[model samples]
Target: MTEQHDEPRSGTSSPAAASPALARLVGMPAPDFAEHVWSRAPLLTRGSDLPRDFADLFGPDAVDELVARRALRTPFARMAKDGTTLADRTFTLGGGVGAGIGDQLSEDRVLRELAGGATLVLQALHRSWAPVQDFAAALADDLGHPVQVNAYVTPPQNQGFSDHYDVHDVFVLQVAGEKRWRIRPPVLEAPLRDQPWERHRAAVEQAAQSEPFLEETLRPGDCLYLPRGWLHSATALGGTSIHLTIGVHAWTRRHLVDAVLGRIGARLSADVEARRSLPVDPGRSSGSEVAFGEDAEVVRSLVAKALHDLSVGEVVEALRPQVRAAQRAEPLGVLDQVERATHDEQGGTTWRVRRHLAAHWEDAGDSPVLVSRVGRLEVSADDRDAVAEVLDGIRDAGDLDPRLRRRLALAGLLVPADVSGE
Candidate 1:
């Protein structure tokens, strides 16, 4: 039978509705957290320290529900035992009768693996699970970075994976049972996506031998923050342990550099000098090699010039699509959304950014355009502020012009936001 999950406790007010999720999550004020902890250091806070237990985010029931009843497909979930991932075939089978897709996760197989002490890993919980989806989306908005979620359900006294570090920062939220986490300083600090822990396995193994910076068993409601490249590992203490790992793919200087370099390359591509063929006659060179000295000098000069001419606006614009692709907000129900748009044509209901959209104003031939994820929206000069307000996530929709609201809604840029309590 298919099981549907509604809003699970969610602790305080809805993050998407009320306040910043980060403040409620980290057990510290948002500003303090930004200054002290963020990507700089590791922080471990007890549940009592937090506003409430993470019962709202996810729990044991969620684990069982995802593995068994969700008709979960492969890659969405996996299992590992003793630091090695179990083969997919061992726990997967094609759905029989009405269901035609192969590689669906076998509920019985999952149960067998669970009974035999394999750690069940539910990947990308932010996309599937309801409660964590809202929580993660709000966190992404709060952090101004992309966020992903995974759940690790380990058997008692069993460890899933060996000690290793991740390339992106992660918050280890202990949802249920007990897990003893050991934290260590990173061999490579604040590593980027290209730099996986596997690349530094030798150093990581050696570091694991040293005394850990922190070794604490987390009960429900406890939270641990580990910055990217910080080494860590955990084991279920006694009974089953379920924890949600929220990974923040924080923006870094490296990303900015890449964007700048990309723009530079793009600008150079239009230059005839950049596309000119290298010395066709290599035989004339001293060693018969393709003498790149003169060409290298010319290319260097062109790159330097391009860098000077490259605008920050161009770089930011180039990076928008990538950022949009990596992160997501709530999905819209088109029928209901359209109905709301039709009903609220007179502007009585509140509207929020559709999928938490980001946009910039540009002057097109026809007045001004609001360039957003959906497309360019040509707005009259007077109505731009109201549109901007909705994009800014303003709570007031009581006075918005009805026609403007309807246009924004149909454009896939704004949707009805239920911010009643807030």
Candidate 2:
């Protein structure tokens, strides 16, 4: 049975009496929590009652510590008679530097400054941060793929970012402040790759050739969902403002097709189609003298089959489980221990094992029987039930039978918990 979790206020629109039409627009579709807004413009809505104390989500102390340690970049700006004037700047992190008036500021500094000054943006410091992780989990449940958080802080009367767009679909949450947003209709829809900024600039220039979309202000608890290639700019109103921009990684049909072709290419290496020799003639052959080998025909047929599989979306479906598994997988550490073998003659073999679990493992067929956060053993018809049962019976450091435990150790499934143990 597929499990559904309620969307978190920080990452998505809250379900507190939203209009039916608006609810449908924001709800992540099924199978996976992916939205169907491919090649569309941004959608805005008011009355999205977001959580208060959102600033505590990033921990002001941590922000202060990071700033004190010089672990972040800081860019200062002051309002001038002409426009915003650039003040002092420093690069504390490893990102490259540029000479533009505002480009010298680190993203960390820009984000923190925006958070302190604006209440409309949510600040999700890092994916590993608990609140950020929790917000991502909720989004992942809706988007189906892992969702990453990018924080932004917009100060009043100050432009947060230059006119541009992002490569991924973004859900902007108005956490605590007010900000004005000017978004152009989406052009060059579904553009991907790292060159989104360049593409956005080109698109905005093109849009400006016509009538540009005017600006709109977002008060606290408002949200805006902008699809890829929708150029936009934001500025803080008069007070400090902070917001969270949850970006969903774009997956396209073309990407799915490429992955299937790759998988088929791997399988072809083992078939006669791959082993066949190429036809050659010492003398230049006339049209009548040339003959195509059966192998050549076989290869042509194999490639056609691979293309057909891609056309049918089989490859995309096959990859979905893997993607889901990666989205749910947790990080591993040295202190974790597991039992790998059972010796009825004695008891059970216990040993400590260390390995990074696959980031996604929601589906049973994705991997052989293994332990996971959901519980110890998850068996399916496709698995060898006997092996899985045996593995499941072994648990913890002190519970394994000695003889079986040694075998498990040899298999790398178990190791001595105590380094000094004889």
Q: Which structure among the candidates has the greatest lDDT?
A: 1
Q: Candidate 2 local accuracy as lDDT?
A: 0.50
Instruction: Give lDDT tens digits, candidate 1, residues 1-422.
Output: 01111322223322232336886666556765676667877777777667778887788788778866888987998899988999998888888899867778888998899889899999999998988888888888888888999999898999999999999989888888899888888899889889999999999999999998888888988888888998998999988999999999998888889899999988988999999887676465675335666777899999999999988899888788777677654567788778888988554667776665566888766578887656677999877787677567564555667777777787777666773211
Clashing pairs in 1: none
**Model 1: number of backbone collisions:** 0
After superposition, which runs of candidate 1 have C-alpha atoms over 4 Å from their true positions? 1-19, 283-290, 343-352, 374-386, 389-403, 419-422
Query: Candidate 2, residues 1-422: lDDT per residue as tens digits?
Result: 11112333222534333232223225322322233343344556554333342444444443444344433333222211112333434222344455333333354644554444422222334343565665565555445445676565445677645667777788776666688887776666677765576645666767745554546787765667787777777777777556767777766776676678777886677667576666675443554433545545677898877666544455755665546455543322233323323332344433454222222223456444444322344334443343334445444534444544454444344444443211
Query: CA lDDT of 212 in candidate 2?
Result: 49
Error at 265, model 2, angstroms:
1.1
Give me the runs in candidate 2 sitting further than 4 Å from their true place: 1-39, 48-62, 69-89, 93-124, 209-214, 275-300, 307-422
